[model samples]
Target chain A: MKRRQFIRTAGATVAGIAAAPYILPSGSLFAATGNRRVGHVVFCMFAGGVRNIETVHMNDGNLLPNLITGAGGISPDILGGMTALPAAAAQSLQTFGTVFKEFRYAQGPTGHFNGHTTAITGQYTQVDLNLRERPEKPTVFELYRKHNNPATSALNAWWVSNGLGPYPSLNYSNYPGYGIGFGANMIAANSLVNADAYSVIGNTKNFTDPQLAKAAALRDFLDQQFKTLTPDSARLNTASDETRLKLFINSLYTKAFSGQFNDPLQTGPGVMNGDLYNIAFAEEVITEFKPELLVVNLQGVDVCHSNFTEYCDNIRKSDYAVRHLWDKIQATPGMANDTVLIVAPEHGRNYDPNTLIDSYGRRAFDHTGDASSREIFCLIAGPSSVVKQNQLISTNMGESIDIVPTIAWLLGFDSAIPSGLLPGSPLTAAFN
Target chain B: MYIHKLNIVIITLVIILGMLVSACKKKETTYYYEVPDAAVTGSSVIKPNQKSTLEYVSILYADLMGQSIPQPELTRMVTAYEAFGDDRIIEDLIIRNLLNRQDADIPTTPEMRANPTQFVDAMYQRFLVRKPNDYERMYWVQQIQQDTSLHPDILYYAVLTSAEYRHY
Candidate 1:
């Protein structure tokens, strides 16, 4: 009669039913190989901090004038200067109107490292030292990799960025040797390193007759090498290391086939619009793998620290990248039916006029002060008509702890996994 | 015995079905306040008790500028009062002046250094507009001299709450 007893009995029944293959068609077997009950998620983490007044709650037109109809003190020329983009790019911004309607601001500890960790883990801790020394917590990526069906060749989750310090220290993530520095290096490496013959076979999608033969041959060679090179004494270590290596190799081929493997050429200099790169990369991955879940943290907005003049401009660019990702997913096959995109900032900037001036005369206010500085937007968009359109969720009472459990709920995971680390409730307004 | 076994199996199945149904049903107990549309509406009404202390000081400077008070008289009054009260009021005015200027540098001339009465009078004219009640003015003057450890924020809040600061 109790909930646990009920779940155990139901789970046993479902397990018995699921073990039988006679109930499924031959084509359904392929669906079973991939995650049949899985839901795909593309998360856009607006790294660094975005001012709440400027992006989400900009009722006044001081920061972004274009967002307002009749402005107050801001000049028209300055507003136009901030948004001088092509018409097609400008139109893409509207797809996010529904997303912005469901926006919820997240609050947490104010530093860059702490904010980033909280954004992924949905747990707040004062991690002042290096991120590697921080306590372990399960990220959304870790959860998916642990529970999702593993017959697929590619990685179930990836952490890619142009330059965002170190990846969150979660045990289950597949860190694809890509950082801000490595992103540039990878781009350059692509141009210099010739494609290997083995890589060429992996890049093609000709899975019929001859290609099938080639796949079998490659699998056989690897199996024989795996046997001779790795003894049974070190099987566990060798297997894990080999699995990681295969994942890396498969990711490279996935990139090559998608045509994004060629080093992304920087147009001028500096950090080459990481927001734009993340958008392009997510699009390529969705098209190739149609992954059950993906997380991409865009870092160009943090360039505000370098020069305040670029802050608004970077925000607009990041907004456009998010819109583009959503639009592509809506158009992609199979994904159009059941994918959801959640976009949010890791933290926010201080609005106090005192600390607004930096060494370069740039506005660098305190981000750890009152509630305003801690406010940053969270947006969710999906095919499921769950949330009411154009609805706003007040985040004053919410904390950074709600995100992971909310994500798990949306993915239909059993809530029995007590999210003790996250003490807040899910944003039920986001669901039907 | 056979009938008992059947009853147990049926009970287990019923319980399992109940769990699935309950779990699938959305949680209805959570409550959220729908964000009001009026929060984002634009208006031009001047809010009461919202002018910061720094803004009040700027009003004082504007009044002095309007009346063409000599720099020496203004500096003397401000400096003499600076020693009697919290230093942040005088400090805030100096900082505001530097920020508003194109060169972004504070004035350091002797004429600007020795004027306090003229500075106070000018600020009273600009910020108070009409005039402060005799009792209110006396209270402020007495408090400034007596309260040497007041924080800038508290001073600003006090100024904002004043009737003269509210109307102007």
Candidate 2:
């Protein structure tokens, strides 16, 4: 080969080798060691906040009448999935998971953005309620992906947020050390379902000659415009990683459009529930990609800010989605055997009811001012061997930030590095 | 058998050449961030002409569709691009949806089929906000002419989904 050609080929080969690890599947990239007990971890952020009264510790049928008694109870799992302290007479304590009913947002700003970020990053940031900025610290996804060194092509981590607002930046952190590239594959579930994005993006087979020409002509036009800007300015992935991710997403979108994977909201009363759609899609992702870590953000229950009846209804739906989502995950072929699921609301609701009432004349509860917002709970469940089912760890006294370290401990990724001055530690007491 | 022999020869050659290249460059690194240095503090690297995210999204939307993208959809588009690493797929879907709208007055099938070059030219004007150069016009016209299966819709989709349409 000519000298110039040889240099070019060698450089390309080196770049390929460097990028190869990130462009491969996680299974082929990292061997499961004895220390790695958890094969997969799913973190479900029951966002928009939930109150302790409505969850974990509902007083008979007083707080949420519908969940406990009204019209023969909407969700059996809501009652079935928790252990009431002292065992309430009307409610049973039998559950499929361990619930930390005494948990609180002991640290961090007490709201959706801060709580969720703290839950994922194991650190607190003073970032305002504005959703403009990503987390300052590395998230559990970035930590797992970076520490484990999964191939970029492997769908190692995903964040399926139910809404688009204040959530656009949470898929990854903006930390200088761990930013853009290492972030999770985020899907704004609401955008996907509500916009019927699947129908438009997934219908690739119908690309007629005319359509291709339009696309090409647009490309040609755009190319000239791009010339005025500085070249190579965009933060682009390695060509291989880009190609693989695009193809994988394209195939998944196709499968979604084909109705191969059933969306719960696609039919019946579930269609009215956005949280259910998010859960169904989360389940689809878990089954399809089998990501090492998956974060599901469901915020429909936040309707309590205005409409109490809708809020209660949404909580019931969210509860059902949670139970159904877990069932689906456990039933999925690869995920069934070994997956750790953590479900927790970002924070809780207000102590006092607001004056404004919904169409049902039921009073609403806001979460911003009251200390009740700090009151939240977490449920951790996985294989019987890993965690004792139906166990309650109320005495552990954990914060939302502890979730990241706990996940790290479970997956045997990186522990909370105290030397680095990170805020939270693993919920080691939750483990057997 | 001959192809296999050629592959083996190429592999060996690549390995030798790669080793030579690596020795010359002691460290190969890709930095995701630029750390500030106190030691070399004076003038800052500035590119004032760089396009803001809003400018990039708005200009493209207005130029292509002759109307502002609804604020909500625009916000979602920006979010999709910023949160997710690549927004090419989202852009394509958005453009298709926008053009397919009833009021978009986008070319009908017959209009696109009758004057293929004219369609391409209009696409350039709408999407790029400039007329297509002779070379671009000729190249696409020739491709469409040569391949009867090549449709005008494909050109529309192409221009709508191009990197230029996405970025400023």
Candidate 3:
């Protein structure tokens, strides 16, 4: 059967078995024998204006002295001033060292749509909605799913959000799996609710056939509700809005068809109000599904539009979350030696010598200015077997175009698939 | 009458002698004169005082023409003229004139031309008193052989340094 039809039938089977307990013995048998080589990639994307000088290149005496270490050394001097990590957690960060050793920023326009698209695709498309117009060029995630074959598993690829919009759904070909629509804050809330829901249904941890069926039914209901609420007119507003809505719809549709939302709600700490909530959701997803490839786009550092003073604080929070995700990945069972973690900002903020406020009050400036606005960081940390360990690789001429190719390379696929469109060199040094 | 006749004969003889002597004086002695090497070769045709002007022109040609000019011909033409020893100054002045006359209509050669080298050699020989060295001679001949422009200005420096205008 085709992948989509198989997913649909599997979902129906899980649901049908749930209503009747006759298939419980067979479900248990299948769960015991299922063996898959799972790989997970966590992307800590600081969507909006995170300045290089403040977060990554903090050498001068700035606000967060502890987080802003001078050149050459790894540890920050003033550990107490950083608000992101707790005292003990901050101490551990000093040992983790700089993750941005091989990272480099790109020069381009500073529009949100342009920067985000460049960050993912490695090519700057003038039209934001051009992906839909031209679907031949595949996204890194889409390519990964195609290579891995998502038909045999319960979970394939998960896009858990922290701050950014729902993952770009235009890149999704007819993939059988769902992309969870819950934003970082929303996902944490849903996980908490789902955890409670799972408990009340008397299915804790072990996802039975019956539980899968019920989750699929709920997913189908939610998909119908979302489609009813979001009319064709509402869905087709702008390119970005349409892209986001499609992702929401696709996630609901995939979940309903796959019966993979068996453990929908699993809640954690009340850190959902700030950047910590994003970290919590990422940690929750990593622990729950153990998905082969997971992309978590953290967006709170873009809080520059709201208040300029808290920009540094927001970046610190993002850094704290990055450290948290790395810690979890290392601690996880299968992810330790196989997984790769990447961190980078979607775009940088403007540079201000005096009060840290640009014209847009969010470091908004020309796209291809100096190092201040154009410069960003990219950090990759994983097992020595999968990625080079404890080495500072040169990134002199690297651009945003390299990200997609680098991801494809790490996944052991020829990234030259989008040859003409991307035209970016893979970060070869990052991997062994 | 005898006395008068005798006086007349003496006077006539004296007059005749004076006229013969004057005639002899008037017939200037033909001296076997040797031509100076400077005059023959036109090397020293330009006096030391006039060396600067030629030198200036040579400099102007070199700079304006760039490395594409045959170096041997330039060196030979500049060295042959006394005024061109200080080629830089003379060259500057010539360049200034050329710049001023840039918009003026340049005369065109109607006939099919020889190579640049052959033209340069022919022009050099036509203007100079003595022929240049085999290398210098061949240099302009080759240039003219390549590009046909019978106009002397095409080989202006070579023509200027030649022996043809030395007397003038």
Candidate 4:
């Protein structure tokens, strides 16, 4: 061969040799040794266009007191200057783990759905108004389900959405090699378990155990026959898991009717909203399943679009709910001391207030994808042994796309998924 | 002369009976019956695309209620149904809820047990929009025949939530 031809051939041979192993082995990209720091992770997309002025900024820092640390960025007097909050079980989350106060969403239109897509898929997305469409890339749930050691099922991956819209579709994607079957089990907690739903499905027939068994058996037979013709008829959960879910749903209905769910959140000051109810129900899920990967988004703060005062109030309530979630996780038997809770707003709100002003003379804001809107914060809190304690980073250290890879790394299977798929790496500073 | 008279009487009675038999046979009409023609092709192939949430709820309502659901009710059911992530569990609960309603247009257990094939064929046409293949017909028919605990409500629930029925 001529010299030029020899160089081209050698390059192709070497590239092929390097790629052959990852393509052949379905295990790990770098053959990782499976050792995990934490067994459970709860990713909270603390969304609804949170602005830094209300949060990390010490002047107006009462909004997220549970998260902001009184270290280098703010003086202790700022926290002391704020009105006292209701006493809670745990201390500041930042004291328990690391906080990146100036984290950036990096690239993407600051739409709520786009922010969610970035956080869940770990990839920046272009503006797409179709909130109902699945992400173009595999979700962290799919990657974990497909690549984790000692393969797990759908129940282990749970997503609890505050309301509706695109929240339901975030559990899975239309990406090839991953779809509904490998998707996470999700529930729009507020929408699925509420007074409205109770009014309708509350008194549904309670099938006898034997009758349910017969129906399940018959369904399996029909499903098997149908699967022969249509391969994709298979669903995410298995038969037994499906039964468990059915019973769980039934129990929710029972609770709704049995007077067990009598205004769990207080009315005045307690701020009964979908976001609070969402985390409340997610606590129920954690109690039941103790899922390995749980993603629950709270967006009550999005009211900033119209009511600034309510938004601030919601911020306070949202902080309380988040802290409550952390406390509940600590109290749960299996998840206590073993779970990592990662909370971050999907994106920030516009710096400039909108035309409307609330009764408190504060103007409402919108997430217009401006500079302020692109700035957000992230808190990675867990047991101090696994996560760094009382550490705070005020500068921009990580991007929104880093969450998936961070989750993969914490779960100890980062090398299993193709690194090229996730441009972001684990936020190592948060961990030891 | 007397024996000849008796033989004539017997031959006359035989001719009268033959005429009566032929007339009775002509009065009866011969006809054939088959299953109602399916809106879709009568084959084993299923619809290519799955039904949307609205479509599934509408068709399921129509199939069970034997009438179109009201617009408000359709929206309500869809909202509640879409709330749950697992379609299987939600579908089961809804199916059971609908089956318990007084308006649920399912065949009575006696009606189903009386003629298994007719009930199975009606269900296939109602939900799947096609006839059940031989194996399906045989299996379900046998199941209905042998299984004393089989309830027509569950039979309807099974076929309604079947993978094939999820499509057009």
Query: Using lDDT as the measure, which candidate wins?
Result: 4
Ranking by DockQ: 4, 2, 1, 3
True contacts kept of 2: 0.28
Please, what are the lDDT tens digits per residue for candidate 1 over residues A1-432?
999999999999998788666433221222223213226666678766777776655432434222211234433433543544322233322233233422333544577767666766667656564743433455555444333333222243544443422442321222332111111001111211124322211232212344334333433432332222222221111334333433443565565667653434222233336567656666665665576666666666665654454676676667656666777887888877577677677777766644445333556445664666577667666654644444455544344566665665556542433346455566666656
* Cα-based RMSD of candidate 1: 33.5
Model 3, which residues run further than 4 Å from truth?
Answer: A1-38, A60-84, A88-108, A128-137, A149-154, A163-272, A353-371, A393-395, A415-421, B1-168
Badly placed stretches (over 4 Å) of model 2 are: A1-34, A61-96, A152-154, A195-205, A208-272, A306-313, A352-364, A369-371, A415-421, B1-86, B96-160
Q: Which candidate has the highest DockQ of all?
A: 4
Fraction of the native A-B contacts that model 3 recovers: 0.00
TM-score for candidate 1:
0.49
Better of 1 and 3 by lDDT: 1
| lDDT by residue (tens digit), candidate 4, A1-432 | 999999999999999799776652334444455578899999998999898778877545456766765433222433332223465334689889999988999887999999998999999999586957999999999988888876788889998888777778888999988888779998986777766665455557666878777877887887766533444754889989987887787777677677655555433353467877888788878877999999999898899999876777677778878888998999999899999999999999999989998666667899988999999889999988899998989888998999999999889878778759999989998998
Q: TM-score-based ranking, best first?
A: 4, 2, 1, 3
lDDT of 3 at A90: 37
Choose 2 or 4, whichever is better by DockQ.
Answer: 4
- Fraction of native contacts in model 1? 0.00
DockQ values per model: 0.00, 0.14, 0.00, 0.27
- Chain A TM-score of model 1 versus the true structure? 0.64
What value of lDDT does candidate 3 attain over all alpha carbons?
0.46
lDDT of 2 by residue, A129-210 (tens): 7756777788777777656633333266788877766676776777765665667777765565433454334334345545
TM-score each candidate: 0.49, 0.67, 0.45, 0.82
RMSD after CA superposition, every candidate: 33.5, 16.0, 37.4, 13.2
Restricted to chain B, the TM-score per model reads: 0.27, 0.54, 0.29, 0.70
